[model samples]
Target: MASTLKAVGRNVLFGLLMAAAFPIALAAQPSHPSQKVTVLKVNNGQEVLVEINGEGRAVRLACIQAPLEQQQPWANQARTALSNALPQGSVVEMELRARDVYGRVVARLLKEKIDIASPLISRGHVFAYDGYLGRCDDLNYPRLERQAQRSKAGLWAVEGGVSRPWDLIEASGRQTQP
Candidate 1:
């Protein structure tokens, strides 16, 4: 009986060691952020509704948070802006930050050398998602964002200026008027 108990203990230790190895190996792998995805939809800002390959999953645009559909001056405009940014055959490079509760890829998207997320913020089409603002890591987004706001660029052109994407998501699903 004692010998059997000792064997079980050894197996548990081996199992724990094996489990630990997987994550470390995965982490060691380079962050191949970009994926071959098609633009399925584009909300205001850089929030693109995309269809990812491999899993063929539809996910919200990663990184910066764009205004919701109804909140924009023209709900369609929100989509149009993103559509213009990422046209058909556009392949985005996404640095997978994490997966939200819904399993969507929350990432910092890129197009060539341009950091896609920053442009959305600086362009005033989207805001730094307050939930994970993270100091606007790559770009000096705040300064550019200010310029966009002052100029009333894109979504900022609305009446009261702009509203946070999170606020729009949180508020009743009503569109904001200019």
Candidate 2:
């Protein structure tokens, strides 16, 4: 019993040491570490799972709303278009913004010197999400969204128009509420 207790204490100490060392190690890494990632798969219109130097992480495009799957009219199309735009295996420079509730990194990606979100937005594959406007300081965001709305691009071409994902989610919540 004494030997077991000693072993357990050593294990706890080791765990604490590792836990404390982790942040120090992470902080030692370069600020704004060059995040070169390869798109492994499109999780949704607004998110992708990427591999950066063999580490995988979820990256949610900042300041954008892609249709939820059931939102239809263009949910799959949005994902497909985004996938085509950020072809699998293509390397991109990800500018980190913040992390979402789902623990996904929020970032704007650049591919071939072009903002990855631009074509997607201009083509109406996604909406300029205004919920977290403070983090979305992109000036072209609203203009591109408006252009898509006016030009009847992508889902905007659907009859009665496409619903924003956040709105759809809110509506769903209301419906489900007592």
Question: What's each prediction's TM-score?
Answer: 0.61, 0.74
Note the Cα lDDT for every prediction shown: 0.62, 0.81
**Candidate 1 accuracy as lDDT:** 0.62
Give per-residue CA lDDT, model 1, range 99-177, as digits (tens). Answer: 6666666666667757665666666767655345242344455666778888887778778876675676556675432
TM-score of 2: 0.74
Candidate 1: regions farther than 4 A off: 1-46, 49-53, 133-136, 168-178
Give candidate 2 regions above 4 Å deviation: 1-34, 174-178
How far off is residue 71 in model 1, in Å? 1.4
Q: On residues 48-163, what C-alpha lDDT tens digit does candidate 2 reach at each position? A: 99996688898988888888878775778788888888888999999887777667888888898688888888898888875553577544788898898899998788877787
User: What is the number of residue pairs that collide in model 2?
Assistant: 0
